[model samples]
Target: MATSSFSSFILIFSLLSFCAIAIPEPRPASWSSKTFGPDGPWNAVEVVIGGVGQNRTAVFPGHAWHSWFTSTDYCFLTSSDHCNDAGGYPLRNSGSSRVSMEFLQPAQEWMAGVRVAGEDGFMYLDDMDLLFKGDNTDYITKTSLAIISDQMLALPNGTQYPALLGCLSLGSPEANQTFVEVPGPNLNGTMIPWPLAKRGATPSSSFGLHIGSGITVARMQGSLFWGGYDRNRVVGDVLALDGGFYEPILLKNIAITVVKGASPFAFPSTSKPGLLAQGNSSLSSSAGLPIVIDPCSPYLSLPRSTCDAIASHLPVTYCPNLGLYIWDMTSPKTTQILTSASALSFTLPGGTNTQTLTIHVPFRHLNLTLSKPLALAPTQYFPCYTSSGTRASVLGRAFLQDAFLSANWESSRVWLAQAPGPNIQPGSNPVGILPGDTAIQSGGNDWATSWDGFWTPLSEKQANGTEGIPAPAPVGAGNKEGEGLSAGAKAGISIGVAFFAAGLIGLGILLWRRGWIGPSTSGFARQESEIALEGRHSVEMETAMPNSSRGGGWGPVEVAGTSVRDPIPLGEVDGTSSSSSKKGLATSGRHVRSLHALA
Candidate 1:
């Protein structure tokens, strides 16, 4: 029995040691670390709307446009370095100056050429200017490496339109030339630029595109992560696709359900809860419809038949005067009628091992207002444009607001997740988009060990060469805990508190002494007297005659062609008149005389 007990003790000790060795280490608390490799999963610069400071936020007047603009200090081909400089002409030059032109192309009919480098690099333009701050360096470097613009559009007729980067001046008119040119047509009918076309063979030249959604409309500081995505922001599993041609991302099926009120119009009784499915053999009606995700467009462009089916249930009307279809929700009842009218669900094809992905869109996204360029006057409108032809259907910002998209160009695959709602707190954990793989492991780490096993108390350090991970900053250190406060800071805070308390007490005492705290006899009497005087003054002012009449006479009547005798005073007219009447008349006459004198 003693030998068996000893053996069991040895076995337990071995099992504990193995478990400890198998656990993974906890991540550092800093904003970023080198654990994810040198090419970071860095935090994307936030692009805020309607806030303070330069590049901190931009005011978007209308909901139609999604174009981003930043302030730029430099202009192309300008020799005047101090055009808008605060200093005089020919200011000091720096050795680190470099010059590059930035071509800004928005979905709107506007384009601009911004100078990003050289001696005139740090010049400032207006609020609409595109500034090349330090944050833009990554994009700039990636553009230079690719030696081509990524804004190319593939047409339906096997034609490709290469976007213009900008025209760079070589100091002379003849030497000035465009930076990137479109390659001639090829036999294979490939639409991709030559530089990006070779990306398949040369994977090193590839990059990723990550688009982040802001939680709330008011605090909508959306982010565009160029290389990777914030792992914490994603709500559901990330669905990956092999690749796409003209429309890179596609949806397999679309299901529309009216969650609350009755449809504003009518639909077929057979299709109570509308379901438009594709790909699966069961859903026949929605088999041929192709859907594309386009953030550039603010509205969802659907096929005419599908749009008609959906529109039949919406409470909208065509306003010929405004030249737009308004979602006549001006009335409170009409607005309430659509409290929870409809919901749109998008389904994507997933492989056997993975579950299919679906993104849900509420009626709130579809119900928006037209502002600025889209309308002559601001009007409530629904964004459901229809196209009868066999053009690819588009899912715009209305769909993306609730969905997070991560496009990895290197792998030619896109990962999408259901975005967290506005109420959800944002997390700082970011995960890198690895090249060539559609499948992603959670936490951006593939280690088999558990994270808890590696978590050691910060007070203990390993005697070996391995360094201990620093603990997270103490909670409320700089706030209520006063851990970050200096001796002088603590003293100042105490003094301030004391002064504030004393001031409050002094104010209360003064209010009490003045009988303002509660009603006192003397204070009440004084108020009553003031009120009585005001009442008397008002009566006297009302009885006083106009200045012109006051100077003319006291109480007389005039006829157009006849003289009328003035009426005698009450006291004089009747011998029985009281003394009060005489006093009132005298007071009135005195008030009338004073008014005339002031005038």
Candidate 2:
């Protein structure tokens, strides 16, 4: 009797299912945003690693390495313990705080980045204690470890970490290729990119960076973003790299120009040879030039031939023993080059059939300094170093100082744009770069929103500001908003509203059949598909990455883990900067006829 009654109810429900009705799709949820304090989704967020000065230590976090900060970004270990190597001078802070590090893993993993005074540095990763949570960002703020790199160490004659620490061996929660992945047994460690994604704060594993200009010129603090980019930091055309986000860029030309008379005098022209090509570039020999962008890299490591060419024009001398150019303080050429020079331009494929991209790094930006073990006293030097022949040449912090970079794992896309010059403060408005297929949306809100004026969408601005081609518009948009509805909009609404009533009636009937509402078939609660909550206490995720044939060449410092000789971390960056006047504006202009030329 019960089976016959159930069969009769199913037959009636199937007949009612033919009604025309609609169900709206649910909105995607994400973190909300703000103009100050906490950053919005995909906006700039500062990750403090080291503390500085004597008075402000209390305000910093627990893991902050309180050390003396320097303008020139010389990489150092903050721990107090010294290594076996006593040959070099250390770049660190006070005597109280030393390099606080412990190495538990047995394998000495060979890493890339940060060319050391000796060799590349390597360290081990501890796995058991860390989980990525939006509230507690240990994977970013302070390191969660049992023990790490206690063996091979250098830097800090006896001090602590200062300023910011950029790149590390921390692997992405998704793919290590996205963030700095240290390929272990199976991509074992977790880093910054993962937490943002796991928490739904970011649409995907992505980050944007703009290190800001030198203190001498801009005095701007660096900007960092998770899963999104600041729309204002970039100016001119946005170049989408042809290669993978993990690979090097193709350099079309590099020219240094000096203003002479009316036009600009330039060198390293196609025929003149300003910058040379690197043989060790990941690309083919004929492919223009390959340059890796590293925030931790303090100096601009280029081809030796390029350095030779640049040296001949300036007063700086290359001391092969030191692997750097020495600025002869007494030379008149030194003074002239520093003040009279105009710009050093690096031209790249503009991502268009017609236009090309050019980033003019101010000649004044190349000024750098060396102190202590590397030098007897503080000395100013040009920041160009000959590229080590092992891997691709590096376009370190020196270049990033004037360039904008954005990376995304979901889209596997990387973008490069010219950074704004000194004294120009652009507003902060971060937009998220959503997941695979890379359909971008308004990040701070769960629903997708289109970012206007993001790519300089205006016609006039696109022409003068962008330089040439712009990247594609952001993908995806949420509910539409407007003052008045158009014919199509009105029609869509009418259909939607009409279906709403019908949909409710259908829902009632379905509920009744399922013993959900006003029903008495069995009288039991039905299981819900999903639940909304106010958030939990903890969020955990797995870590690892696939092996890749590509990587950047870092350095010689070793953090004695396991001597298996495998690729490791990318180095850190900081440059000595001074922004006094270039000297003799009218004086130099009058001498242009006898001074120099553009080409």
Best by TM-score: 2
User: Model 1 off-target regions past 4 Å?
Assistant: 1-220, 244-252, 258-286, 318-325, 331-334, 351-355, 387-390, 441-599
User: By TM-score, how accurate is candidate 1?
Assistant: 0.41
- What is each predicted model's overall lDDT from 0 to 1? 0.32, 0.38
lDDT by residue (tens digit), candidate 2, 163-231 = 222133222213321112223332222343554465544556666666554333223334455667665
For candidate 1, what is the lDDT? 0.32
Task: Please state every model's RMSD to the true fold in angstroms.
Answer: 36.1, 18.2
Give the lowest summed-lDDT range of ten residues in model 2. Answer: 582-591
Among residues 3 or more apart in sequence or in different chains, the pairs in candidate 1 whose N, CA or C atoms overlap within 3 Å are 70-129, 71-131, 73-123, 73-124, 98-117, 98-118, 99-117, 99-118
Off by over 4 Å in 2: 1-166, 169-188, 242-244, 258-274, 277-285, 350-355, 387-391, 436-599
